[model samples]
Target: MSLRRRIAAVAAGVLAAPLVSVALPSAPAFAHGYISSPPSRQAQCAAKTVSCGAIQWEPQSVEGPKGLRSCNGGVAHFAELNDNNKGWRVSNVGRTVTFNWVFTARHRTANYEYYVGGQRVANISGNNQQPPATVSHTVTLPSSGRQTVLAIWNIGDTANAFYSCVDVNAG
Candidate 1:
């Protein structure tokens, strides 16, 4: 091949590389985060502490639109998490308890919100950085009772958020 032809081919290949990648299907987004500690409803399902359906396979993926309050996080299939069941193990927690989030794929978070009995308790502003494998937050519960704590992870750049409902007996 001529040097000019060779150089042209190389240049063409270099220019097309990015386009090819953009055209191809991207990697599977294992992109989900869920509360594992204090064992959220989904966490219980994953741990077999509670018998559940598809949620057992993807506890971290219980996500939905942002700014909405729902146990399933707007995921209708996961509505069972809202169902009252004595089988769901309750964690006895203190006034200040730490909840751990296990992320399969990290996204820039907007903020972390904790709610109890339909009231917002703690709000941790996100740093907008890709979070590590596990993110822990120590929240001070302003009230006490056998209440379910709903933890919401709001993504900074997206209109979606992940939800995890943890059953806890505030002691």
Candidate 2:
């Protein structure tokens, strides 16, 4: 073949190489759920009038390790949320208070657990098959001056986790 033709062929080969190579797989997808009934409005009331005020919570996303890409990579986990001790604050005034939460998972099912003042209040596993889900629960205030409400979520296979909270009035 002619020198010019050979050079042209080499350049063509190099350019085409990228097209032949396979692309990296995309990260998995996850959904965010919603907080169920006893709507926020119903729960919201004068901190002094109600024995317990309304509380709302949700899972939060976090940054994951370097390069270890996953739908929830760098995402916060349930353990991390609690360890950080970051959540909503509520008053436990011995009134009937309600807690609500919702979230979705990616590539797998999710599990949720609720707690108040370090005591377990409710647990729901496999809430939904897809992302954008919702779950909730309610409890009475301890009649104490103030209380804390905690909500945690575990996404499927991936280590992604999140949590959030609201403050309620304690009677």
Candidate 3:
């Protein structure tokens, strides 16, 4: 090839390489899941029942390191969920109540845990498989009164878990 032609071909390849990369798709944001039934804190935010910050835009992103007891999964932008006086709507139910979880991105789960009054009330095994769009667990309240239930979704393949808090008046 002539020297001038070689220089032109090299320039064309270098310029096209940048355009090819720019046209490629980028990674998607990890928006997972949250509890909907009985209206978890994130649900309320998504529904506009409670005014929240960025969590309202993405209720299914309350993900963090496993074993976290925080409603917002310790995410700084969702700190409002950690507020005790956020005026969250409370759902009234019987001693035996069923909690429902809605998943946006189904993942292989290790287990599902529910806690009330600092005590675990139920632990449903996920069997290390992907769950359906929605999953439910029934648990009897320890006592009758207003309480906050913390629901946790432990991912089987990751060191993270999704957190949600539901206020309820169990009778």
**Global lDDT of model 1:** 0.89
TM-score of each: 0.83, 0.43, 0.86
Runs of candidate 3 exceeding 4 Å displacement: 1-25
Candidate 1, clashing residue pairs?
none
Q: Which stretches of candidate 1 lie over 4 Å from their true place?
A: 1-28
* Local accuracy by lDDT, each model: 0.89, 0.44, 0.92
What ranges in model 2 sit over 4 Å off? 1-96, 104-107, 139-144
Please provide, for model 2 over 7-107, each residue's C-alpha lDDT reduced to its tens digit, 9 standing for 90 to 100.
Answer: 99999999987776645555644444433323221122212222322212222232233233222233433233232233333344346655565444443
Colliding residue pairs in candidate 3:
none
Q: Sort the predicted structures by lDDT, highest score first.
A: 3, 1, 2
lDDT of 1 by residue, 1-171 (tens): 999999999999999999999999987567699998988999899988899988999898888998877779888888888887647899999888999999997899889999987899999988887788899999988778788888999998899999999988888
Instruction: Give the winner by lDDT.
Output: 3
lDDT of 3: 0.92
Q: Across residues 1-171, which tens digit of lDDT does each residue of candidate 3 receive?
A: 999999999999999998999999988676788889899999999999999899998999999999888898989999999998999999999999888899889889999988987899989999999999998888888899999999999999999999999999999
Residue-pair clashes per candidate: 0, 29, 0
